[model samples]
Target: MIDLLLQYGLFLAKTLTVVVAIALLMMAAVRARRGMGGSDDGDRLEILDLNERYKSLEQALKESCLSKKAYRAYVKAERKRRKARDKAQTEERQRLFVIDFNGDLRATEVAALRVLVTTILLDRRDGDQVLVRIENAGGTVHEHGLAASQLARLRAKGIHLTVAVDKVAASGGYLMACVADRIVAAPFAVIGSIGVLAELPNFHRLLERHGVDFELHTAGEYKRTLTLFGENTDAAREKLKGQLEDTHGLFKDFIREYRPALDLERVATGEYWHGSQAVALGLIDAIQTSDDLLLTASETTDLLQLKYSAHKKPIERLLASLQSAVAGRLAAWVGR
Candidate 1:
């Protein structure tokens, strides 16, 4: 099972690399157009009416079955019904503010998440709910920590904050998830990995054989506990392991602080679990997808999706183009 997970992890890494390459290409095009004084502005607070989608589907079905005159009459009645429904929602003074976080290992979405959260904080009153649809497999410590703090801001405002995981939210992702007032995961979604991991390759032996000298100076004793080229002493390696264990302790404490009901000792072993299993282990609140939650919430409240977009750097764009080109060639070769 561990081997399978490792293999799957590799596949996921490659898939995400491809996704990143494509996103970078699109961003580069946007950047070029903007450089030419194109009036293409970036992201804003988007309010999506989930009902509009369902309504369109309903109208399509009605149109296929009803005569032209009957369809026209049906459409007029439907408009009236929708107006009444919208009025009721306004009267109730309830709303659903949706945000999305597709996190990379670096947790790059944190910046956008912070912007969106602050916007919601400014105007969101009581009876207003926030929903975050998160897709992440965790990453660096401080990065995900900052991301989790962004979510924490919503709860700090005395507003209800719910998070839905449709695919995976392990490790640093779960670090952020545990901050939610409620967590909902799809049945097949990967949900838990209540542990910490750190790994690297050492090349000191190769360097020594090649008559290369590498010197790393640290002002503090534990400043550089592990290295890529310099020899790693037993004491240094132990210090690194100790640091990981300390991080694991902090992670467990964070989870317990937010969700004290979970049996942390039983499940915080760095083992990933499916949605149903996670629910049983008390790692999540419910077993349901984001789509279902949005559909159900939209029936009575106005569902608005919030997003934040920014510009990318030129060098980053160039690197992405190169990666995409290489990936494209490999794909073509595989096809042949």
Candidate 2:
């Protein structure tokens, strides 16, 4: 009974925190909407040097909860050697511009993507390379297409573009990845799903059962072929199917234009493959993880991670707060 009460109390606290976070966000959004958002910094750019990240890694290693015998021995020697060499080499001959793309179903990161790429184009010069670490399970067609086009801009500048997939890149994700000069993925990371897909629930029958009527008007005959509340005709369904086919064809053409080595007919069948399998199908150029790629780049080049700093909106702050709270609670629960 005591434990149950404690759990309930914790749950209530978390719920209240989330509610407060959301309320603050709503207030902030309303103020911004009314042009009264004083001091709300729009987005800003944040650049993190990969070599400097080792400081955090060293701290984390020291705080490891796992058995640290073999790991400590190896990392200790490497760290000492790296420290000795760091003083001698203040700069590298080649520089790698790293961008991270963590996408959602709507390709929400496309705005950041555009900003980062444009900045690189303006500032980067010869002997520089762009490495995009992308983790996306694909998203809306036009949105991801725009994201891929943003990547294409780097390629157009004769920049050596390398895409590193750490987790998964399918559908629209693969669309963007294929635009790179090289695609690298982990041994078991998901790579390809070069197919277009769209789905929406239709409520026409439910509306009919409820005796509710819905009428939609459009300028063209095909303006709104299939709708959520309207009865879909056979023609409407066929038209949607035809549109999907056309989109798929363009997807294939785009990939072929960029990655001519890939066998489009086989890989573009809406089937996803792991890194090794993708490499075998010529969908991915190499089988390696993004972490390894970053470490390698740090050795041969100055690795700089690019991020667009934007003044966090109310919702963004709220989300970050919620994430931090949840992580803290989870860590406590795990005794970590």
TM-score of each: 0.79, 0.74
Computed on alpha carbons, the lDDT of every model, listed in order, comes to 0.84, 0.83
* lDDT by residue for model 2 (269-324), tens: 98888888888899888998888888877767878888896667789868756654
lDDT of 1 by residue, 166-213 (tens): 888888888999999999999977877888888999999999999999
Candidate with maximal TM-score: 1
Scored by lDDT, model 1 comes in at: 0.84
Worst 10 residues of 1 by lDDT: 327-336
Model 1 ranges off by over 4 Å? 1-43, 83-92, 317-336
Error of 2 at 24 (Å): 20
- Superposition error at 210 for model 1 (Å): 1.6
Tell me the lDDT of model 2 at 97: 90
